[model samples]
Target: MDTIVYAIPVFMVMIVIEIVTTIIRKKDYYRLNDAINSLSAGMMSITSGIILKIVEVTIYTGIFSAVALMEFDSSELWVWLFAFVIYDFFYYWTHRMGHEVNILWAAHAVHHQSEEYNLTTALRQTSSRFILGWLFYIPMAIIGIPPLVFFTVGLINLLYQFWVHTRHIPKLGWYEHYFVTPSNHRVHHAKNRKYLDKNYGGVFIIWDRMFGTFQEEDEQYESIRYGTLKPLRSWNPVWANLHLYSDMWKDAKATKSWKEKLTLWFRKTGYRPADVAAPMKMPDIHGYQNYDPALSTSQQLYAGVQFFILLLGTTALMAVYHTTPTWFDALWIIVLGANLVMNGSILEKPEQAIKLECLRFSITASALAVTATLMPVASIFWLGLGSLAVLSLAYLRRYSSATEPTAAIES
Candidate 1:
């Protein structure tokens, strides 16, 4: 059974509850563009996992078969508990280094790009984290923890983290002393000097306290600023994943010293060569504001509608990926990813967003036509394509005007 899959409904319910609770308390912690962008990054992460997970499984299985020192049975409860604790120990180092090291942060920074701290922000995962994340769990394979046990425990740890991302949850008294609570995890996400690089534990706060990375929530000081040191201003999910890596590449190219160019990836997190000048002024955290772009009511509604449709399609793809044909699965992922890229563009209100949306729908229409012709059931696919075509035409007619004012929505 897929543990993450089973937890999806629970996560959705908790998110709805958080939204309602925040509304009741009159705290506006969410923006439409920010929430949608966060969720889009999450959906893209899952889609990318469909392929990248094979590499992880292959590497771990190969290493275990070749070099495992002991056989740990998954059927034993004690063995499962041991594996759980050990996995989190390694996860701590992986996560901590992700902040301190330059190359690893390139992939892990996507999760910290959101300025709003909400339930949706928990899902803002990095699609490129698979590049190095699998390496952190190899100790389990080396000690002969069964792959099934490792997978299940890791899923449980991740599900435990979902509840701690919200601002609605306060300090949980003694529970905060033992486990990772919303208070400490909130400190983990903050960019302030006091809170920076603290709370690296995944399942237990004990690790952070033991390792000296712990910091209690200081309410008297500055309010938490949720984002990276450098703001990712745009809403593009693909760019969100690649921006830091691209920055590293640009810095490396601009440097005069060959040794500096090669060592930059392995250096400390914010290191820059003397020869290469800083690009811009450091962001002012005290007077910082969330990146909320102006969009017309029509554009906002259009993005919301399309985002809902694409999210449904993504959920279906994830649920049945095992049984789905390879080509159809690839096509579905590509279309959904393209849909999100254009959605981000629309939210950012760029001049080319409308054109991108039109092109995306045009390609989707063609894909549906091909799917209808090839698949045994054609009516459903044709009906979907027709509805999409009509929606695209209406959107172009309504919002493609040059004189349309950039109106913004608060929610």
Candidate 2:
């Protein structure tokens, strides 16, 4: 059973509850643009997962079948419990190394792009994690951990981490010492000098405490600063995923020595070629602000409406994804990815957003046309699309006057 899929409703409910609670408390934690971007990145991660999961399962299955150390029955409760702990043990190392290594950080950095820490921030996972992530769990396969056990425990571990990405929850008394709570995980996400590279455990905080990577959330010392040292100024999901890799590529190309180029990726996190590395300056945490391009009411409406529509499309895609041909699945991913890119542009209020949106709408319309020509599409879909397009243009026209001056929404 895909536990994560079954828990989607619960996740949505929790997010809504968090939003309402924060509002009721007279504190603002969720920003519309950041939340949308975070969710969009998560959507991309799911879409990518649909394609990459096959490779992951194949590799794990092949290795397990080839080397049968000892067949452990997954039906036993102890087996399940042991699998949970062991999987988390490996996850700690995988997550820790993800921060320490360069190429791995390229994929993991997407989760840290959002400056705001909220429930949606937890969903901002990397689409490329499957590339090297499987390496961590290969040990489980060698130890004869059944695939079913691994899958279920992995999902359980992930679901356990979801609730910790909020500020509403205070530290638990004794529970804080053993398990990961909101307080400790907040330190994990902090970019402050005192808290960097701390609290790498998933379900258990004991691992970090044991390994000396644990940092307590001390109010007297320094408040937590979320996000990486280099801010992701743009909201594009695709760029969010690839920006670090792009930086690494440029650094590699600029270096004179081949050894430097080859080893740059494997080197410590934030290590750049001497020629490329800028002088380190203390980060102005107080001056740091969230990236908020002043979006007009109409622009915000357009983004919200289109994103809702795309969310529907994404849900539909997930429903039929497994039944569809591989090509159609790939096409669905491309269309959705492009939508996210254009949506990011709209949020940024870039000059090119207009052109990009036109191209995006045209692509969507053309895809519908092609799809209709190939087979019968429901009339309701066409009706919805036509209504949405008309409403979008009307909103844009009505709100055009408000966009003359770009106002940055200060954090």
Q: Which one wins on TM-score?
A: 2
Per-residue lDDT of candidate 2, residues 85-175 (tens digit): 9999999999999999999999999998889999999999999888898999998999899898888899889989999999999989999
Report the Cα lDDT for residue 222, model 2: 66
Q: Provide the clash count, candidate 2.
A: 0
Candidate 1 lands at a TM-score of 0.93
Which residue window of length 10 is worst by lDDT in model 2?
Answer: 373-382
What does the lDDT read for residue 306 in candidate 2?
82
Q: Encode model 1's per-residue lDDT on 1-411: one tens digit a residue.
A: 244566667777887898888889999887778989999999998887887778888888888888999989888999989988988899899999999899899989999999999989999999987788898888889989888888888878887888899998889899989898899999999999889899999889899999999999998988888899888988899999999999889999999999999999988888888789654455678776667878767777777777876776677667767765777767777877888988898788645666786688787777777666544433444555566667867877755665256643332
